[model samples]
Target chain A: MCESIPKTMKAIVFHGPHDVSTEIRETPKIEKADDVILKVKYSGLCGTDLHSYRGHIKGPVDQIIGHEFLGEIVAKGSDISDSEFKIGDDVLSTFTIQCGICWYCKHGYSGQCDKTNTFGKVGLPGGQAEYVRIPYAKSTLIKKPASQDHADDSVYVLMADIFITGYYGVKKIVDFLGQKPAVGVQQLEIKDATILQYMVLAPLGVGPVGLCALRVLNHLGFKKVVCVDNVPSRLEEAKRLGAYKTINFETEPTLLKEVIEKDTGNVGFDAVLEVVGASAALKTAYDSVRRNGFISSLGMGHEPLPFNGLDCYLKNINISFGRCHVWSLFPEALEIFETLKGDFASFIDHKVSLDESKEAFELFDQHKVSKVVFDLTL
Target chain B: MCESIPKTMKAIVFHGPHDVSTEIRETPKIEKADDVILKVKYSGLCGTDLHSYRGHIKGPVDQIIGHEFLGEIVAKGSDISDSEFKIGDDVLSTFTIQCGICWYCKHGYSGQCDKTNTFGKVGLPGGQAEYVRIPYAKSTLIKKPASQDHADDSVYVLMADIFITGYYGVKKIVDFLGQKPAVGVQQLEIKDATILQYMVLAPLGVGPVGLCALRVLNHLGFKKVVCVDNVPSRLEEAKRLGAYKTINFETEPTLLKEVIEKDTGNVGFDAVLEVVGASAALKTAYDSVRRNGFISSLGMGHEPLPFNGLDCYLKNINISFGRCHVWSLFPEALEIFETLKGDFASFIDHKVSLDESKEAFELFDQHKVSKVVFDLTL
Candidate 1:
């Protein structure tokens, strides 16, 4: 395995805002006893990566800049047990490293773990390279099916972040509707018969996470999924993924709330999944939801969202916002990926070589691509 | 019963902002078939009453002005058939009239009933008189134990509004903590062991609702309950009830967040009950809650509470605001009152005849009294 690994590998390195370039960096080694070296096969660009590239998120200069990746274990430290991980084993890396023994990780809230550190962003080196080092390998690495080849791995790359995030938003909405995950129930049961059956759903921001949420909702049997976005391509994609209705905010003179209420028979949607971090989108979710409806916020907006206390009080809307507990949901998400079988790959609109990452970042920022995956082998 | 009923009764009526007056008005009779005329023995004034008196909440001119009352059913319509209630039976009225058959009512959310109307506010006539009609008596009235007398009924009178409102606030916090009331569990159990034990609590605005919340928290065995208020008397009352610490915001140089953190071992309060409708108090609650903590809002603020979405999102704080489902929790609250006998009466600081209601409103408005109860037969 060491003979196959190179001394240096090509990586897209960040040097402050809008200053990213392909550079040769020494391949990462096992600095900790629990660390494992992975030969990167695929890496996906996310909204947070764009933020880091734009310097909205501060991090070390010249850091390898990517968090979502699928790879094979090339080398492991002495402490890595063969039962947990082995060389040549296919695996996906989580965006954040979580100590599985922490209180948050133990309670299925690994996103908020005390020692959590996101790769390529702040605390750790990233995966936008030919080889990357993974710390806390036992907890951070999820084994992908050995039968799956590179041609079908893009969806698995998403399992690292956005897919689980989108699923988390839907889970929050279901939980908000009082349908907790039962021990023996095969499907989520609606606890309240009067709860409007959650027939209609609107996913604001038809970005990668939003599209994933739409697809998941479609798989979950939501009857009328309304997709909202200003981008025409995203709307088209949403429709192809079974969105019952699509609303383009830029072209429509009527407010989103008005259009949604009209489309939903003037009662408003049963629930809205807000993936756009903008307060305007949140406000649309708030206004478009029916009484006792929920707005599951999975966005990361910097601005304060103006909430009318009286309005929220009277409507009794439930808004839940947080980062995705990706590690906790990895097993179920993998099962879902296997079940969906190539359905999620349609979201990968562009797969560019590692050298094209700088341009990919610009294109993604310009909304030219729905999802951009980095082909490390290219 | 008809011969003993009077043609007129003296009641406090809302004419406009600060224009409430005691006037002799025609006594209300059972208009609806399910309506019952209650001869009000005791009526508790609430913060909402002050809002109506200040012209903040619109209502009919010269309408009776109290919603929290304990009374005897003096007259019943022909259709009254609920075996639990009858003429001459002692009862307490909920602030809002619930039909008990609407979808919301059937689903245990009577507070959101489509036909719901708060007494003395908006369309419904109120109970601040010798006689007032209560619609949907079977769903709206709770039978007072025959063993309890009128003098010991102040706590029961609170069941109509503030007590339940306070308990509802606490209930939201407990629910946010993931401790739903189990079938036979006497105490609310912390479902998640990793969830910080809810040791410290702060009830902002030590008014009737705040006092009731503090009392409920005491009964639930919470340690280190902090009461925040500018009123010295209310603080003393809170301490009398079992507040571990009291902060006089008006006199404190430090901000509420700072004070709370200092009092709570540099970690913010586990949960905060926001009872003041002011945005400032809501802001304090937002700032004082620890990570993954809850802020249960039970206040009615006309102005939009300025919420920092990013801050709340990053902290993973849960903010739930709504009116109390009083009818649904009446049984448990009554049992709690029975268990904590005579303990809640300290909240009734002053009692006066119906004629002195105008002065009582003024004194209460000036924050001179903790709770003012109107004695109809005084």
Candidate 2:
């Protein structure tokens, strides 16, 4: 099945901190009974990839460094079931491969599964190469929707990480606000009222994830969406993408909380999406939310959060934070992407060939681009 | 109506820290047009009352030092319609007087209303007296159900604070664990599965609130409830009240997380009800919850909570902490109290006349009694 594929292919490899290069490497093959080979089509550079590149997230030397990709299956192992997924299928694989039978996976928390492993991190090969091997192919590979344009395919690539993550963050916020008692007859009505009253939301840190969250929240019919960021370009993009208001943190001498309070008539936002993963950003979210509000944190900060438990207690805040279990939201995300119909394409400010991935990373790290997609076809 | 009632009454007044005395004070009258006067019957002592007594919670020097009470309406203002409540009606007033027309009151968060005021707190006169004034009578006073007796009335006294607070804590934990997606067909099934799989609950601190929480959890069909505290008598009381396991922290050298993990087969409790306001108890609750578990904090700590935000994020834990909006759960709590019969009366380890209230306060502050009730009939 792999006869037509080359043994050696071009791949972007992570060598060490501040080091990445396009190198010729042996193409991955079906290594296990459940493994399948994928001919990579498109890959997206994420914040975590930047973290890995900067050595903040340590990994093996000479490791392939990308996780978000859509690809066509080229080969399959002997034990693979062609009935469920066959050769030549266009698919998008989640970064986290869940066993599907683990306790966490069964409970809809696939990201925390005991057998879960991520691509481009410590244990598995990444999707930035010409060809990659995917384990647990049946459960991990989601067949791409039959929308064959590059723009549509770019949306699918986002479904592998940031878009789903952003969606999950917003979903959590809505859930927190709309949570109702288990035994109330008026639960449905209460939930509806909660959502209606809590239409105002703020997405902090207008990076790819935050922008996507803004898009998702707007798409969900939230009328009052505020975008906060220090970067002018990102804020502009956020404004273009339906932020009711934008706050440039760099220009504003006032605190973010004060700005939000002023905009929200001192009621504060019903929810804050903290996507920067810094304590300051989280604190802003905490301060900007009204009593009985939510802070949905999507950022991965390594530092111990500066938390005032008393403040959280007094405010009655509900905070939901963790990695996005992409597979859990995969079906809905694909449907949303289809409905969006190229709206998400505006987020991709830069596109580069795999050869220019190093430059792309540097530009992304410096906040020169909102999102950078690697056109593997190039 | 005014001629029959006395112009003055004996009330427990707070002069300063550790300076509480029974004094003859001017009797409360119908200050608001919607107010009603009640002849105080039974009043319950609470941890917050102790805070006010110790000056940890600031109040007027002559502020009354009680909030939880049940009584019979003696007089009513002209605006109070006798349709829902009338003179001589047995009733219990929530600690919070919710206007019911405010945004928070109408939205089911009456405790957070702009016009909400707590009895025995800064702005509201308390019920630890011969007679008490209740504002927003129609919304604030809950008519006692037909099944009336002194024992049942004592349980109703709990509804004004600890029992309702305890019930609210458990409700929050259940809501956090059983949280469903805002948009999904399988929400009901998912919620059921979540509750079934996550039946193990731990209530930290076997105080009156914690004991009430245990009783509520047990009544809710949770089979594996663990009670943790340092007091042997309280632990024994917890065991008597339906705790599946008990962990006395004073005698146990092992960490709470280790003990819980061992008890739960290396999987921690699905939810923790933290009734002690101390940071150590909060930390223990945080450490003992499983991944994606919930910690419902009911305690009010003066100091900032010792928090590790990274740990919370990585664990994917859901923490809901706040003062109990007791009025929010008033209806359900009343129903539950009725079904509980006199079962909750065991928590009242001491009952004294109004004259012996000083000794009762000392005993409660020293943890020599689980709960103290003022029998106004004496």
Candidate 3:
């Protein structure tokens, strides 16, 4: 396993706030019984990665930083069973390491496992590199579905986090709507087509996360989903991806009235997807949802949510807030990616070599680019 | 149809805050063709009634004031199907009027229906009377289940609101746990008995609502439930109702430490049932829940919930807030009542005559009594 490996490989290293560079580093090896060394194929930029770039999450300087990675395993540990996984198997990983035996891991709470560790921070060098060591690889890395074998690996990088996250929130909304996907095909068909009376709000104008959610919503036979943002171009992008309506909340002084009075006949929406992670946007979601409605919010905001218990109770609002747990829903997201690979790739407008880590982060920070992926093959 | 009924009857009339009196009033008649007259049997005094008494919810003063009622249909509208419900059938009424034709009612959101009006407020006389007019009788009232007909009518009164509320919140917990009941019996059994490592917190020491929830939790075969309160008597009551652990937060200097370190071994509870509608209690629920845990909060509070968006995001918390819609879960509550009628009635320490309206309200307001019901037969 070590004979053919290089002594040094290029990795995007985080030096400080607004400081990231592709630097030569010694290749990682399989150090543990369950560890596997993955040859990184493609890795995408994410909001959490930006948190490091902007200094909001502060110094873990000189470490490789990216959690969304899809790749092929080049080496495996002795304890790793070959039947479940083998060397050269193509795979995708969750944002964090998971010890499969923990209470959280066994119960489908992959994000909060007892032995969980994020790949990019706290001393774990992430996949913005040529080769990465994955501990607990048997549990952490899922095989690339045969259905998506031919799909672009960049598209599957979305599966590592954003696509699954988008899918997670949409699945929750389906639960809220009481919509059950058909047993075999597993496409959520709203029981009554007339249930189009129920509307959903997804912020598809910001990032790939919301657009991916929009894509799943349309695939589920929903016809009353709305997307909102200030940018006309993003709103147009959302509309192109099957958003039923769009609101430029920046320009519309009557955003609430329009959504409530025009779109939903004054009852407001049945569910809202909050991906903006801002109090103002959360307020809009709260204000637009009808009594007994639910909000599936995955936005990672640092601000306090603007909500009072009495206000929520009075309207009978239901809200589920969290980051997506990426284990169970991985295959489902891959299944989705098989059909909408190009549509998902449309959001990833920037694909560059690891050397452009500085430019990519800068462009993403300025909102000049919506999504970026490092082509490690480059 | 109501020829045998008396012209005048005893009623509890709210003249002002802290001023309720038993007075003889003209018996209610079927004023609308959609109305049905119910001969009140048992009427529960609720926390909302205290809201009126304490002038918190300034009311339609001088009106009959009770929403939780069990009764016999004395007379009914011509449109009310005699085949479905003949005169003299025992029935239970939801706390509010529900018009079945509305989208809310059709979709099981009976609490927020198009024609939702609380029975005790806004000029509609509630069930604190010998005879009460029930509008939307076809949809508002449900027949007493044959199983619970022989049980205490007061326990069935619990079904009208609190029992169902407790059940609603618990059902959400079941959803959160991803525990599905058996297809036939519909009792949520944890897939693995060892999964009891997941804990739940229900404030069973506060009121009949929490105890009623505790009853449902145990019936579902859940083994680990903790109850918290300052009162020793309430904690004892909770223990009697099958709480596995009780924490008196007031006396415990290390309340969070005890629950986190000792009870759950440092990971917090898997779910929290929030029925105490105060900021402090909500904070406790927020603190005690583990990452990826859910808080099924039905607590209606006036103050802002003490939480920041970032903290909730970091914890990956899931919270659902609402008043329970009583229509769909009524039969399920009756099923629980069939088994736990005595246990539910154990919490209702006050059973008084209609003439004792003032006494019952005073006792409940002062916390001298846990639950009170007007026994019309007295």
Best by lDDT: 3
DockQ by candidate, in order: 0.25, 0.38, 0.40
**Interface RMSD, per-candidate values to 1 decimal:** 8.6, 4.7, 8.3
lDDT of 3 at B55: 88
Tens digit per residue, CA lDDT, model 3, A163-232: 8888888888877666321111112233543545568887624467888898888887777888888877
Model 3 chain B weakest 10-residue run by lDDT: B180-189
Please identify which of the two predictions, 2 or 3, would achieve the higher DockQ against the true structure.
Answer: 3
Question: Which is better, 1 or 2, measured by TM-score?
Answer: 2
**Which CAPRI tier for candidate 2?**
acceptable
lDDT of 1 by residue, A1-378 (tens): 478888889998989888888899998888888999999999988777777677777856878878999899999988888888889899988888987765456656678777899888656889888899999888899788766555567667788898888888876665565632111101213364433346455588888788888878778767578888888988888888888878888997475656555665565776888887788888888888876667888888777775778877887666777788788777766667676747777778889898887799889888778788898766
lDDT of 1 by residue, B311-348 (tens): 75787666777788788667666667676657777778
Residue A354 lDDT (model 2): 89
User: In model 2, which runs have C-alpha deviations exceeding 4 angstroms?
Assistant: A54-60, A148-152, A181-197, A252-265, B16-18, B52-60, B148-152, B181-197, B253-265
Local distance difference test, per candidate? 0.77, 0.77, 0.80
Give the worst 10-residue stretch by lDDT in candidate 2 chain B: B181-190
Worst-scoring 10-residue span by lDDT in model 2 chain A: A181-190
Clashes of 1: 0
> Candidate 2 has which clashing residue pairs, if any?
none
